[model samples]
Target: MADSTGKTDKDVAPQIQATDVQVEKRASDDESAEKGVFEHINLNKNISARIKNPLADLSPAQVLRDVEEFANEHGLVDVLPALKKGALVARDPDHYESVPDMTPEDLTTIDDEVTHKWRQPRRLYFTIILCSIGAAVQGWDQTGSNGANLSFPDALGIPEKDNPNAARNQWLVGVVNAGPYIASACLGCWLSDPVNNYFGRRGAIFGSAVFCFIAPIGSAVCQTWPQLFITRLLLGLGMGLKGSTIPIFCAENTPAAIRGGLVMSWQLWTAFGIFLGFCANLAVKDTGDISWRLQLGSAFIPAVPLLIGVYFCPESPRWYIKKQRIKEAFESLRALRNTELQAARDLYYIYSQIKVEREIAGDGNYVTRFIELFTIPRVRRATLASGTVMLAQQMCGINIVAFYSSTIFEKANATVTEALFASWGFGLVNFLFAFPAIFTIDTYGRRALLIFTFPQMAWTLLAAGFCFYIPTESRAHLACVALFVFLFAAFYSPGEGPVPFTYSAEVFPLSHREVGMSWAVATCLGWAAVLSITFPRMLAVMTPTGAFGFYAALNVTALVMIFLWVPETKQRTLEELDYIFAVPTRIHMRYQAFKVFPWWCQKYILRRNVTLEPLYKFDGVQTRGDNRAVKE
Candidate 1:
């Protein structure tokens, strides 16, 4: 039978057997050589030979040229197969390349194994759960502060009802509460790279957990708004670290088939934390002075288990490989994967990619590494995609509802008690809608979801805004506003909510992942800071109707950006993305609608007679359907 690449079993089997015999003969010769009085000397020579690093001496361009020359001279179909069969090795004696187990059909088998092993092992599930809890703590902080803001004004002597300084106090409320995003944008973004590089993923998480644990207690006991603001700012630092680390940690560890959904658990648990925060508000809304403090302090509760549990989880195998702790990487992969073969295959892929990246990056410093994001075409495309998704996520106005829902409800003429309960309902809708993403994100793809749901979100925001034109005190108007808010959550939750985090996490190569994710998170927090600082003023000047209309316009802009730029990543291994982004911009945009629209329509609306395939594939040197091979 022919394999997926159309080579028959008979045509491939003998070559594989020949390669195996050659490898075995080499091993036998080496073993025979080591059995003499000169054995220790021979061993030392072998060790020295194996210690040389190919990437240290070669430029990326030179390496690429050498690989192409080697392939051509050997008449090889692909570099990987030759490398696997021991036909290709670095010229220097000290450079090492682990030969993967080979059959002539090994490539096809590897692809099949990757697909079959798509489901991660149970230990990986524990890692996902641990990272998800860190995300929940972040989520808890997001809406937990919203709840506390409601009562803290009264308890802390800030002006509210008829005070002349109410406008200033409102601005202060927005700014102080927005401190986390600001801190994340400024310090957390830059810190994430070095912290992850030096401390490892688990260590960074532990540090964040300590900050998360302590900051909330300060918020709980602070008697003054300034004290509370300082505590919240510190909390933002922890959040910034968690925001940068957890998604990368999760994405690096997961199988490609479920990577999107697993990374998106960050947002899923964020919504859950918001739900818990809203419930806390309802529980304490009627209590006297301590209500807000207790609500804010409750964010600390999840950090305990997060700190303890993360210690037991495996470090990212990719990170271990990057650090050249090959033994640890192997053990970690074994711990997280279904079988030893699968682990070996994963290691082979990671090792190959790391070699290429090291040659390309060339012992660059952090600043040089950051500059490479813009200088490298594939890396630049990924950075732009990640940054745009994050910006779109913040501009979608989800945070307006998340952070200011209680105030918005009150503005609609619901009593404080009624508004707190209504906020709970809003949080519930968000939490419930997030569940659909877990099932659909991998199957339906990230770009399609963003395209399909964005316009729906825009329309709901417009309708919700128009609802405010009804008399403020009318029960019908209040119900209409609440209904539209719930609809907005429904539309936003399944797509835009999770796609940003997943897309950002998966886009960067292992070499630049931490810095890339940090930049993406910084984009998210920077825009969030803009929204949080401005939403109160916008609400005052433009009315709720006009503010919602403005956000609706931003959603339309985001839709245009996504359509023009973002590529489908579903079912593609993270390594394959190098080729995906290499597709020229004009070609990608021209074909994007054909790729994204049919899938969205069939899955959500039509449900029949649709066949979907990846927009691009690499066959030997060629990109399928395109005449020219993609040169990397």
Candidate 2:
């Protein structure tokens, strides 16, 4: 057809070449289209990289280096992809804009918000009311014994604080408070199952509430000091047992992200209870016969609402899942989350993770579960770190400050009312600073705060000790003590106080967390009990300077402990941590060797701190209900 106007075949060949170029371009386009949606190379790999690298490097140095080279060589091409292509793609402006961006379709609202909602949900509201009441009881117990030395003589029919028989009253007052704390360590663990199974969290809490209610009333009616001690012991048991359950219930019910903060409300309320008792003391300051019994008895008032309200609250979804009541578990999950579909998704997600943890933990008896918690290297490390931090927390001279504030102030030459007022400042600072943790903990993170603040606390303690040792009754000495004391309390409230409990709750496996926490609490109480008993004796022997010096050294040790141990738990989910730590692969590096050490020590003990990678990797794991993969 072109021949009618054809100039030459060569010109026709040029036209044909153009047509061929078009066909080739179209073929390339079709090939790319068939390959589909830009071929995402699994961002999952990027997230899992930290987990994988550690695993690949296990063994002898030669083997590790060889594996590293192989991985690096093989990874070069994909890892070095062109940045231009990544920059070219633009996200759609409108696609996700309308989505409400609800808390995962699987996750529920946190406890604090749920407790504070405009039309408060029944479970959260009731739980808060119950916990608050329990906290108030705890407050009463802690504060009831505060003025015991002053009034015990009258209450117990002793003639004076120095009565040879006064040891009985002193012992009753101090030891009685400790009894529940020690008993709680065992009872909480032993009773958790029955509480969860025979009765729900609600029922367990209700029983504890009943004890709180009765113990206080009994405390008021006791004619003999022994009777008073027995009642206080019962109250302690209730508080300890019930207090252990709060972390469990709060942690299990809330989302992983904010669970730590929510559970901390228990302590916050505990402080508030102390504050209330202070108020009560102020109210009754002038009344001579304002019996210690009446002060103790007032603890029961809050329990009335809790005893009545807790029965209406929901059971733990974790507990339900443990019992294999999947339907009821899902129902509980939904009620907590405030939706069915999302609740089911979260339930399934948690249920699967729980299944994984159980399998990884292996088949074992109850005692074995206890052993396994500490047997795994990673979990054991976490447990040791948590327990040590707690140890440091108690010995950091805090409880001494708290238990003997009046005495300490008096020794510094302050009057009784002035000492009490200064102690009030300590309480006020504690309460105020604590609220910031609720807001910033999830943001600034647990590890950063602990590490940064502990050193500050150590230095403050050192300086305070120096101030005390200066041999002065000057106002400057008193002022220095006051500043450091308040600073120390502020540091403890946000950093150590809530963090140990939060970290311990987060790190331990769910199956063992209840018992582990019970024991951990026991350790905390055990150490505090020891220190409290000995502190008075130490004060008598060493005087303030020696005692403060001893505690200041303890702070230094705590700082070192925190440095050597303590991994970051910020923004990590409980399930991910479990899988990460289970990996058998970990780097065992002895940074330096001390030549004179025993061969046995060299064989079994680390010469210096060792950094081991997690035993396993769940870096790429994705929950069924959430798109986000495991955080490394």
Clashing pairs in 2: 582-615, 582-616, 583-615, 583-616, 584-615
Task: List TM-scores for all candidates, in order.
Answer: 0.79, 0.71
Please tell me which predicted candidate would have the highest lDDT against the true structure: 1
Provide the clashing-pair count of each candidate structure: 3, 5
lDDT (0 to 1) per candidate: 0.74, 0.56
Tell me the deviation in Å of residue 186 in model 1: 0.5
lDDT for position 579 in model 2 = 39
Candidate 1 Cα errors over 4 Å, as ranges: 1-119, 593-615, 620-632
Encode model 2's per-residue lDDT on 1-632: one tens digit a residue: 12212234355334332111111111112223321111111111222222211111112222223223332443422312211111111011011122233244212332222233233346754555465566667655555555443465466675425667655544444555455555555454356544655676666777888788888788778787767767766776677667656666766776655566666776677667666665565555456665556656777876777777765666778877776676566567657755443353355446545654653455455577668656765556557766877787776777776566655666666665666666667666766677777766666777667766777777776676667754556778777777888888788777776676667666666666665666566667667666655665566567776777788778778866665555556545565455334322222112111222233254558564444343223333322112322321
Candidate 1 lDDT over 184-290, as tens digits, reads 88887678889999999999998888888999889989988899888988988888898899898998888776788788888889899999988888887777788
